[model samples]
Target: MDRHYQNLVQKLEEITHLNGVMSTLGWDQEVMMPAGASEARAKQIAALAGVIHERMTDPALGDCLNELKEKNFDHLNEVERCNIREALHSYELETKVPKRLVQELAELGSRGQGIWVIARQENKFSDFAPVLKRFLELKTEWAQRISPELKPYDANIDLFERGTTMDMITPIFECLKQELIPLIEAIQSQPLQPDTSFLQGRFALDKQEALARAISQDIGFNIAQGRIDVSVHPFCGGSHPTDVRITTRYKDSDFIESLYSVIHETGHALYEQGRPHELGDVPASESLTMGIHESQSLFWERMVAQSKPFCSHYFDTIRAAFPENLKSADVDSFYRAINTCKPDLIRVEADEVTYPLHVILRYEIEKGLFEGSMRVDDLPEIWNESMQKYLGIKPPSDTLGVLQDSHWSGGAFGYFPSYTLGAMYACQFYNTLLREQPDTKKNIASGNFAPIKVWLNEKIHRQGRLYTPQELVQRVTGEALNPDHFIGYLKTKYGEIYQLG
Candidate 1:
């Protein structure tokens, strides 16, 4: 390799390490940092963001990239080729935007998160409105600056998942909404739902934490490299391929909150740990889009963790976790309780059958928010309307409605669609997995995820940014992104739960 390209790769590695640091600090702020450290953390992050932006957009970096653009440059391997392509793409997008804008957005996003934390607690949108509006303005400007050829919204969506656009997403979302609304209504009228009484009671934190650790181990998350903590909003974040950290929220009166969330966050940690040792130029260390990442967590959380076979195998472990509370609880009863088909205000807590409806509602509003059809201040009213339209219930406060998610507050405008996209990815992957290994359910039921995780690592996680989400889905599933798979999954699963006659 030419010294130019070599230097570029080294610089990129440095940038990635810096990014890992930022991730660590961000994770700490959420899980372990004292409340008074918010301001310092924001500035620290802003500085890191500025440094990263400078490195990414440097003229020398652009020159090295231009030099390496030739096909024969240094006889570039596939890894180098991918790195150059993605790096150039990132460079073009970042350099076009002003550094001030980059720093400004970072600072704004940090402050906005703080405001969101407060506003959600207060259940008042007014406290968050001004920063939210500022965030949108900055985001719109940043999007416009990056790709003047495309609409700001489409450009923004492309950031999370490559080549994804409002036009492409709109039809898919339409199909999802069309199917989900009636299905939810029908399921709502059904009588054969799971009894969730087993999930409610005073679940001790120690037991829940112990259960979380055991399940995390079962699912291949290394407890030594990763640790679980409690937080207001559950998430998994960390600095490097090793040293992964995740958080889950607990309700002493509710078990489901911590139970499934641990599984979901563990999905993220496993993927992170599974990243290849070769860093920088290799696509393996690079995570796929947020949507694809979510699919990993959700697949483990819903497709495996919540499956009937799995519950039976682990019922005794679960009972042991809440031995006193679940003295009379059994696998079947626990299964019915967790899969209970009921509408709820919180999206995270919604039953699997009604989950996509929540996604549909957010997708519509997100589209509206991006297209200037929706204003930040009007979000609460619109959220209530969509909640009623989709879920047959309304949130009494914005806290349970639009303010529930930290995505928008963090200046992530085009990320909401990924939740449903992840579900769709999960369905296609799950179907393909069943076909590939008929014993997948059997293995999961036995609390062994090694074989499945290995398959996913080789076929999916290992590919990482080497493939776009579209290519990843097609390659793994032998099919394109199909909502039919997801719909079928819901119908089959819910059919059993609701006994649709």
Candidate 2:
């Protein structure tokens, strides 16, 4: 390799290492760090952020990238060229934003997370709103730095999902709002409701954890490389593909919650594990977008784990885990129970039929907030109002409402739409998998995930960031992203479950 290529790769590796350390620190903060270490963690994260920013914005790196972009650059293969191009794009984006802003955001996020935990537990929005406002202000400034010509919300969305814009998503969300509410109303009008009473009783935390781990393993999570742990909020993160870590919070009253959380996070781990190993630390080797990443989690958590076939296959293990709680409930009842459609205050716990509404609410709130029509102080009241308007339910407190998600606490604006977008992607991908391998449901029913995992790894996970999400969707499904796939899936699945037309 030429000197320019070599230097670029070396610099990229160093930047990747710094990011890996940040990921590890982030994991620790969420999973293992003591509450008292908040201040130290904030400084550590800020220092790392400053170092990474310096490295990313270095003049030497810029020179290397400029040289790589010169005439006759085609000596390198397509993948290498793509990596270089992506690296340059990232470097330019990073250079546009001041290092001070980056450090401030990092520190604020670290400190805000601890405060968020306390504020959530104490059910006090007042304690957390200031930090949230400050984070938003800093993030807005960062977005402006990255793309002053773009709308702030679109610029923020670009950070998590490149090539997506509020204009593209708004109409999709509008279509969903137009269709989903009526579909939900039709389902509610039905006399036959899926019985969910069997899921109400207490299930031991230890047993729940064990069952979650076992299911995650059975579905192809590599325990040697990855492990599950408890956290205030469930998430998946790691320094490298070979060292994945996932966490889930348990509720004694709801085994399904933890189990699905594990499944969801395991999906994320699977994607990381399946990434192309040959690419090493190059940014192009990372997962494509947050939307695609969420697609993986939702694919497992809903399409597989919540499916009737999977329930039939896995019900025995669940029954064995909590015999007392589930003895009288058969697989069919349990499936219906798990799939029951009802509007809920909590987004994570929302049933599939109503989950998109939760995302839509957040997406709209973000659009309003970034567009300057909404203020941070009004989040609680507006959140409650939106919940009532969208889901026909209201949170009793900010903890159960405006403060529910960890995204805003970490300055993850424009991230909520990914959940619903992921659901759409999952539906499209699942349809493709079924068409390609007709026996997928049968294999899942038989507790054989080898084919499913292989399909996903080959089709989606292994590609990494080689393609934009839209390009990937078109290549995989012969169609671009269309919410119709998700809407159709929801209607068909829930129609059968609710006996609605």
Candidate 3:
């Protein structure tokens, strides 16, 4: 190994340790921290961010990277070469923004999260607007500093999923809007609908937790290494892959929210757990992109957990969880209730048929915000209008409208598209998985996910950041991201449920 490369690797390890600390703090802030501790936590996060920024932008790190790039690399392996390449990319992007700005952004993110929670609870968008406006201002400035060539929104998008742009995403979404509107209308016009009454009964939280945990464990989430808890919003975050933490809020009247939140986040934990263990110390070992990461989660939540075979396999468990309520419920009705399509206010709770519409709504609003056509104060109105136009429902309050999501408060512009993109990717990947493993449905029906997990690990999980999202898609499915697979999946699945032609 070259001396400079070794130094670079060592530096990255230090930076990763700091990141681990920051992630721990973040998880604590969301799940366990007292309200009185918010201010101190914000300062701690900001100081850590400043130190990380200084280290990442250090001129010596640049010199080391340049030395490695300038020297002969004939002796190095692929991972070594990738490390230097990824490090150079990170250094360039991080150096663009000033350290002070980075610290300010981190501080604001922490403070904004607390404010957003309060505002949403109170149904008051005004309470959070000023903080959100400041966040947008900082994010826009940071985007400009990073790359003036790329549009401000695209610059932020690249941070999550590189090689993606509005030019590419716009048409894909337009295609979805064209196909889905008619499909939704057709379903609504149907004479018969699924019996969702079985799902409206009181479900015990302890039983829900047990079911969630059982399913999470059955799908390869190592409980010994991971823990599940409740949060205001469900999320998966941990300091290390070995210490994976997942959270889902429970509602006594609804169980799917907690059950599927576990399944969805377990998919994320699986990807995090399956990351190349050999390269754990390198930044290259992290999941490649947010889109790819979301694909894993959506795969489990939609393609696996929501499938007929899965329902057949797990019906008894669900029935047992609520014996009094589900006494009359059968597997078919249970499946339909779980897959029922109702255009709703919440994105996280949306059914598969209407899920992408939620993402599309956010995508358009984000475009307006970044393009200067939309103002912060107008978000609530725009949100209500879009809901009425796209989903045929209007949010009566900001709590269920503009204040519903926690992304903007955290300054995560251009991140919503990943959810829809991931759904498409998951569908395409499922097509190939079924083709390669003919007994996959049988295995899933029999409570055997080893085959499914093994296949995903071989095809997607172990690759880590070695390939971009597009490259990985091509390598696995032999094509670029095709939304037709997702549309076809929805059409076929819903056609069976609603008897649509």
Off by over 4 Å in 1: 71-74, 279-284
- Per-residue alpha-carbon lDDT of candidate 1 for residues 356-430, written as tens digits (9 for 90 to 100): 778778777777877889887898999899888778899988888889988877888787778888988987899
Q: Enumerate residue pairs that collide in model 3.
A: none
Q: Sorted by lDDT, highest first, which candidate order results?
A: 3, 2, 1
Q: Per-residue lDDT tens digits of candidate 2, residues 1-501?
A: 788888888999899888989999999999889889999999999999999999999999998899888847768876687688799899989999998899999999998888898999999999999997897788889888889999998999988888889889998888999998998888778887877777888899999988998889999999999879988899999998898999999988988888998999999999999988678788778888899999999999999999999999989989998888888899889998898888998989898888988998999889998888999899999999988888778999988998888998889898888888899999999999999999999999999999999999999988877788999999888898877788888888888887774
User: Could you estimate the TM-score for every candidate?
Assistant: 0.97, 0.98, 0.99
Indicate whether candidate 1 or candidate 3 has the larger lDDT.
Answer: 3
* Model 2 TM-score relative to the real fold: 0.98
Error of 3 at 147 (Å): 0.9
CA RMSD per model (angstroms): 1.6, 1.0, 0.8
lDDT of each: 0.83, 0.89, 0.91
Model 2 has an lDDT value of 0.89
Flag regions of model 3 displaced more than 4 Å. none
Deviation in Å, model 1, residue 352 alpha carbon: 1.9
Clash-forming residue pairs, model 2: none
